[model samples]
Target: MGKLLSVNLAVPEPNPAKSVGRTGINKRPVDGPVPVRAPGPKHGGLGSGLVGDQIFDVQSHGGDDQAVYAYAREDYDWWQAELGRELPGGLFGENITTVGVDVNGAAIGERWRIGPDVVLQATFGRIPCATFQYKMAEPHWVKRFTQAARPGTYLRIVEPGEIRAGDEVTVVQQPKVRVTIAEGFRALMLEPALLPRLLEVEELPEEDLAEIRKRIARSTRQRD
Candidate 1:
């Protein structure tokens, strides 16, 4: 049931037409992380919120499987009707898509052991933002995504390996916490205070925990 179908990449080039004021390509490259330029931000040029991996993007979040099986084709169609355009394919800009995997239902902190080397962590859910709307050419895309609230997901590369299409993806750990992706999304929006507590649990993998901790501290100081 868990098979890797394909891998894609989108290296950001200077796109001057974006309305959100971001200068990056939507998607490019056939494999590997988007080639980010330096002399930008310390975290490269990745945008905040619904842009970079730690927040809104993923290690590898999309492909044919998700586009066909996981994504809400009807919702996308509705979006097309509402805005007269197609929504972006898959969530998190994943390179490799998985077949027979319910990406949305996969618990937070769940690890998928793909082959001997590559392991992906379902670290968090993607939080849409203004740039998403700009790319979609729809102003209310963020609200629409939030309302639907079942948008795919974000993943982290736990172990680096040569990954190709058609490799079986196996779930290594299903997180115990009852925190749904929707809950995480809502909490991130309404009550960011809960993030620390959620991240403090030992159940979260080390890298995922570290990311949550960084976000918690960053948000805390922003308020103070």
Candidate 2:
């Protein structure tokens, strides 16, 4: 269990001059409770987010599996040290900032009951993208982020409600098969050998699971 330090919302502003793309990567912290719910099923899919939070890349960023992105304060502290600068709660574009809980270590399907009615289940890890690199203005940021292997976890909304800072984040459910966010990140990004392990967690993103299954099937065919 950990404390929810802040709730942030996506800032979708058009920067036509820059190549950052139409992105909602710039997120700012907000006060008090914010409504959380699934966006919608058709088209891109419903994002688990604050009422006003705008998701720019609906097709890739927001959906049932990646409804909410969470990052740990501890990891932020580490980033501050690495960057030699202050890294704020919403700096990584996470919807939820957590304290005392290992966001990366949270197992897939792990459910956190946030606030009174909001329940979010861990599903996948945040994959670095070009937009993020452009926003950070760090060369090789995408590669660096992937190599560092500390990607924060993406969670799906299980129950809708109002969530606020200071809410007690209680791990109400942990699935029998645990595939940690870190493990899933590595398997998806760096290590093909670990792909088979991802299947252990059924709640992972469907596309990712399908991709891994396809790779595993191919490998099996080659062996045959």
Per-prediction tally of clashes = 6, 2
lDDT of candidate 2 over 52-130, digit per residue (tens)? 7777665667777777889999998987787788888887889889998889999989999987799999988899876
User: Which whole-number lDDT from 0 to 100 does residue 220 have in model 2?
Assistant: 87
lDDT of each: 0.50, 0.83
Query: TM-score per candidate, in order?
Result: 0.59, 0.91
- RMSD (Cα, Å) for all candidates, in order, is 7.9, 2.2
- Give the RMSD in angstroms, all C-alphas superposed, for model 2: 2.2
Q: How close is candidate 1 to the true structure, as a TM-score?
A: 0.59
TM-score of 2: 0.91
Model 1, stretches more than 4 Å misplaced? 11-25, 28-92, 190-224
Cα lDDT of model 1 by residue, 14-132, tens digit? 43444323333254224433221111222333332122222123222222111111232344455567667554534334444556666667776677776656666665566665455
Residue 103 C-alpha lDDT in model 1:
65
